[model samples]
Target: MAKSERDHQKVEAAKAVVYIYINHLAYHISPETAVLYFYQLMWDRLTPECLPVRDALTVVIEDEQFKEEQGLQFINRSYYSICNPWHLDNKKRPYLKQIIDRLDREPETESINRTTQALREQWMNFSKGEYGDCLRRQMHLGGHEIFREEDREFRNVLADYLPDYFYLYRSVTRTPDIEQLEQEHSHPEYSGTATKQINRLRESYDAVYEYRNLRQQGVTGIDHPSRLELAEFEKGLDFYYPGRNDSFKSKARTICHKKRRYEKYASYRPQVKEYLMESVELFPARTKSKLTESIDRALVRFDDRTSMDPITSKSLFLGLLDSVLLPVPNTSNILRLERCVGDVGPMNFTGMLLSLVLACPMIRFRLEKKLGYLYRKFEGKSLEGIQWVVDLFEHINLALVMNARKIGYFSLTEPLPDAA
Candidate 1:
């Protein structure tokens, strides 16, 4: 094979492994949680080769080509079942029933057996089914070549790749019979390649774990708005409180009053009653004005109220956060956000909106869950494509550092305390 062909082979192989892993999770666990794991896995650990695979898995979840039917009639055309598993046909294979029962019953050591079954089934069904054209073609090619092998040889080769299939399986599903799996999948001929891939997958898992641990530690910091964004910003005033407090809200409003986060970047904000405007490409002209108006009103209420109730603040903050993070329901909105950020930097758009919420400690705490929801919502999207969101996340991290400093949570100037 040529160099390009070799690279293409590698990419396709990676995609097949990832695809099997995700579908295995969907079959073993709920489809939603399965997608969640995929999102969390790739959210912080996407490589150059992971982009197209991410996009392909997304098609399995929800193909946008049939948007009109899915949106209007509430169809479930996605290969991965987002429906209640019990509602699915149980007579045929009982895959859905077994999945639902596993959730309620004790954790079993049947993961390996189930995964092998899922892998074979997915490979057999891997053709030009209801999936996208590119995926269909790739599936047809892989199936044609692989299925042509003698049954015994095919089974042995698939078993060799069991470790690859269970790469993500261990994380999402219950405990598996690891010892048996290792013994069964151990092929002296392909051991070298299998060992290399297993090591790589473990390293990736460790990296993600460390990143998440750091994220959890730092998710509770305050962010300072730039002078251009805010006329005069005050530092922390009990900004890390986890729940609703009228006093906290009052103190928060005092931190920044004349909010100018929207003005300096998008001149159109001043023209449109100072609302947070989503990308024109993402939100249509008809709906854009309405969105901005809703956000603007919420911010005004949040800022101007002297004695805002917890209920009102909660609703207002959630409205603002949703508008900023998930302007539209489409996955393309995320891609559009990256493009939109180019026009106005992250600090101006996403960073600015986040800063507004950071003022309210109650709402500030909700940021973690909201962002997690975004991650799960657009699970399987390539990190490279969503670099802007990642950048905004880093921006939030910086703000948290500042918040920590202002609140005397820690001092950069002082030495660390001994762990004794």
Candidate 2:
């Protein structure tokens, strides 16, 4: 008979795997390591009951006295770095009229960690099918040793998902990208204060998102970020995961040589921060998750919204012209087509509407702005050539309404009610 591995043995191995995996590949450090470092750094900074092992995930375990004694080693620089507008220096961020910029670039995915079985199980239970996960989601249950292996895997996978982790604290990464919310927030109780702080961070993270989207989408008629600013935003995303070495390549490099008139900023950035923040702010506060239970409830509401509405489910596909269809973006027509519809469609109507959409410069600009597409002056000739698609759509929908009326689409009465 085979002997059983003690639970402690499994945990130790899992811990070693997590540490080594992150060190060799994931870069920076794993959250498991973060937990340990936090314990040592904070030293008695947290009351025993307030420890994160329970439900409290984000209360900073800062040793105030140690911070004073050991100087900057104890500083929680990562927490503050969340606001890129602030200086990288540790101390205080100036409370001036800080401009919150929008980030649209996606993160470098090459070295990011993958989900482990343990984390998948915990997350599945924690999220309760609220926020759908792409990976590590399939393996949610297992035996003792298997559970340990899963935990180690979770450490690996979970580390890569830092942006989503930020959402747990901040209430931003609500699942089911729906037009309307149907549930509340579901912040994990890794720790109370830590969880609360995550919520706060989620708010700030989300606020920056709203500011950028509203500006780009022209939802509020605000000025969109300039091309140079877009380049800078791309550069600013590097800090999300520690020791990230990926690059978002610069158009700045090209422009600088061509004109030699622009100032070039350094480095590439992670784009997740900007995208989710914008999406999170669109919800009403009642539907939004800012507090504990409020957020938990908000997740339920959000899940419902993300659920595709059978009555009016938006088709997700891109259409090519019947005249000439090509996957590559080669012409102004092709670029405009991608810009106007992205990956949304039902095929038949997608091609029809996109051609018209690109026909209107206003709609084109709106789609570009909403998607937060960086507008390169060298690329976009002008927001001019296409500008009348809006009237056409209005005419189309209006005609549809008229036809519906003629066909008696409305049914207001089953029968006439008797009046006294």
Q: Which ten residues in a row have the lowest lDDT in candidate 1?
A: 133-142
> What are the per-residue Cα lDDT tens digits for candidate 2 across 118-160?
2222322322322222111212211213324434243332222
RMSD of each: 21.1, 25.0
lDDT of 2: 0.26
Error of 2 at 417 (Å): 41
lDDT of 1: 0.37
TM per prediction: 0.31, 0.17
State each model's CA lDDT, in order: 0.37, 0.26
Error of 1 at 96 (Å): 28
Q: Candidate 1 regions off by >4 Å?
A: 1-292, 297-307, 327-336, 377-383, 404-420
Which numbered prediction scores highest in TM-score against the true structure? 1
Best by lDDT: 1
lDDT of 2 at 174: 19
